[model samples]
Target chain A: MKENYYQPEIECASVETLKALQDERLVKQVKHVYENVPYYRDLMDKKGVKPEDIKSTADLHKLPFITKADLRDAYPYGLLAKPLDECVRIQSTSGTTGRRVVAFYTQHDVDLWEDCCARAIMAVGGTKEDVCQVSYGYGLFTGGPGLNGGSHKVGCLTLPMSSGNTERQLQFMTDLGATILCCTPSYAAYLGESLHEKGYTPETIPLKAGIFGAEPWTEEMRRDIEKSLGIKAYDIYGLTEISGPGVSFECSEQSGMHINEDHFIAEIINPETGEVLPEGEVGELVFTSLTKEAFPLLRYRTRDLCVLKREKCSCGRTLIKMSKPLGRSDDMMIIRGVNVFPSQIEAVLLNEGYTPNYRIEVDRVNNTDTFDVYVELSPEMFSDTVREITDRENKLAAAMRTMLGIGPKMHLVAPKTIARSEGKAVRVVDKRKLH
Target chain B: MSVKQISVFIENQPGKLAEATRYIAGHGINLRAMSIADTKDFGILRVICDDPEQSAEVLREGGYITNVTEVLAVGINDAPGSLATILEIIAKAGVSVEYTYAFLGTRMEGAFMIFRVDDNAKAAAALEAAGIKTVEQSDMF
Candidate 1:
């Protein structure tokens, strides 16, 4: 019956105190970005704004919104606020066919990001005695490093099983008795299904809680994953662009994820007009990295569509809660914890001497994203032997994996099998009910 | 001598084999001998047909991935040791049999064995040198 929190004062602070903290941090962050990041400084200067123009969070709306386009334009080094020597690491976005946005982090930034994640793990019942297994894809991907560092900070025996090799995941989970699981919802679901298929019930499995995120998942999926694994499924949200998977997290109540408002400030804006929306009003989620040294973004638009609620929580954390992202304003789809764009697929097809006509079918099978890309086959590409055809398909899949980071099932079908669109082509068919 | 054998690439889903068979039958191509080697994702449907070229052409027109493989059709005598003798000769000749199946030869024989061997010409030469008659395409068609 011990009420637990990693950093009680910060996590359970009053809304007034949190607001004051955000305001103080926001003031310092604006000056930091303006001084160190020429890219952001130019952006602010273009809007005829200065560091002294911002006083508090109320003046946050005066700043120009930073979009993904800006991130792309800035590319690898334009937005880097600190010097390379001062920066400890850089995590690049999994985006294809363009210059990837690289988010830089100093050691201090890493510590804060991990601290945010530690609060998340603790909220989900992580303790010093617990063995936390982090199954997120490690390196370049934020899901693994963020949670793994947090687990270490929480004094849990960190199991850095960086995704895939499900057999080993199970072996270590049962043999080592991993008490907490950290990974995407889809992967967690897959693990649960795998364990059950191996005839291990919830009671036999030692895992008590799971923190799943990076991709959107539904409540039904949560319950299904929870039931299968016999663990409470908590959602954690973050983007590599915003220091990755520790920005917000869910507690025991699981109503919604609490945004770690101390390090990062959350805002919602009408995407089309760039006007701030009131609380409870659903819109595009924006973030401002307050304490980050190497990368401090000011009012950075997330492109994710979700609403924020400041109502009282049963978990007793006063952090502002963001509902699960309703959907994205853009065509970006998160499949198996990877950001996939139709343009990336199109780029692959066009580059590989294929027709633009293709169908991308995405579905949740056993809580894992099943991605199938059916490319319309030209007559010349047609073959009679399964061996030759499968070889060709595998080669295409390998190319896609190189481009997408995650491999897709390549199915070369008849030339006219894919339905031709009249007005516009509907390329991606995402069947996951994450909204 | 080697005869043409048709192999179709098919996904491992229920009714796919049926559909492929029906399509072949509808095109008036007779399946003389058939064998399906299945993997987790798909199945390779191989068949000795009355018209291998026509079957392949029709299947390709139907948008099915198909390929033609050359295999030997050896006529086995009506004796227990006859088939064993042919296998022993081929095994000694250093030619590997990838796969094999049987069908009644339309033109002749007690039993005709379709041998999908690594070296069909070599196996055929060994069979011929051993005094075993290998059926030609006309015999199966």
Candidate 2:
């Protein structure tokens, strides 16, 4: 029997109905932004668009695209649609880049955001009977608070165990028989390793499903974590700029994550030209928050490169699906005139039977690109002699060259030399700036 | 017989060796013999210590990647051609050495050479067949 899940009315809406909802929300949100947020209104006016010009989703292209730079310039409250008294909370980006993005949420906006997150939890087979442990970091970062609210919405026993304190995380997880795990994929992988170190097998853990996101992780990592934890690992994709991590989530199908069309309208556009691409064409993912109150981002460039699919999902949700992001256009590195992404390097390492704990160091020495990859040797490979280890490194370099069209100097480091993270793992270190 | 050799990976940076030695010394471990094999990026500090397990544990607690390998320790007279004699015997037996390091023995007339051979058992057989005196872990400590 098909199990009844949460938020069926919106999730299982037909295409016509979903489009109608998007059109209604898009029209209202456009007018809301145009009237209230002068920063976005100026951009719209510059683009020769008025609030009346955007009557439906069909006129979405008429508005100007908002990039992270625009958001950075706007900073706090520049893009806020609602008044400051109406806002309830704020979540900011890690500011790893130039400037941090602060997104505001009114109580209503938080309710809708949590509703989207509840849909994500339900997609992963979450219910009130299950114990849901949210391990994503809380405060400022959208990961923890977003999922925590969603878990509450699902009426599950929620453990707001923010990131860190692994020992306590495991203790509560085991003692409470937590059935659902949520956090960054890297943290999930770390927990898997820790569990093994503590001599606990997958069967000993009560977790049945994991909702992993907040960073771009490869499918190879998904399989590794699944094997380690004995749980179906689901990918949840969202950005703080777009209201944290409930924009989309993978269902039992696991092929792609179904975007909550009622709230978010996703589009793919050519990264270089800014021209919107048709469905199935891989390009930069752009999202327009349809129903956000405080910050209503329209045609916001996400910088993530992925494709979209409208194929019938077996799970019975008519929501459109977005493929796992291939990589971020902003994070793409051009080494020796060739485009390279850390995800590509990660895929190569995992394929060659190496753990995903590898670091890529790129530097310009004497006007030449010096690319070096330091990979942690697995236990089986650790026993190899220096010559044998060098041979393996050469083989890896050859494999990377075949895959990436350019060879990287591979160095085999001892296991665990590379730093692991409780959040996003730092995979690439570009030393060109120091030079 | 094979001697336990604890190898620690140290970055090729200033004071790394000193830091590792300080940690080991703080644990009250004494190195009986030691050698450093270095590359441009990093170095492997291999040592035969009074307590191999305890020394490795101490270095690991100091955040070093330490591995214990079974290495053959052979005694050779401190004279010209003494090292070559053992190498010739092992080569004649079709055994290959991965790496070798030596230090003055805890005696007057000879030095102790550590052999990391491709096959520890095969190397031990070759040395025994040639009537060479091999040092065991107990003998070294």
Backbone clash pairs for candidate 1 read A383-B66, A384-B65, A384-B66, A384-B67
Candidate 1: misplaced stretches above 4 Å?
A: A45-53, A98-101, A125-130, A164-179, A187-208, A224-231, A349-354, A377-384, B1-73, B78-91, B98-102, B108-120, B132-141
Pairs that collide in candidate 2 are none
Candidate 2 residues B60-85, lDDT tens each?
77767778899999988878998999
How large is the interface RMSD of each prediction?
3.5, 2.9
- Model 2, global lDDT: 0.84
Each candidate's chain B TM-score? 0.92, 0.94
**Model 1 chain A lDDT-worst window of ten:** A379-388
- Show the lowest summed lDDT stretch of 10 residues, model 2 chain B: B102-111
Q: Per-residue lDDT of A203-306 in model 2, one digit per residue for the tens?
A: 99889999998765667778988999999999998988889898999999999999999999999999999998999999999999988999889999988889
Candidate 1 lDDT tens digits, A380-418:
665434566678889999999988888999987655768
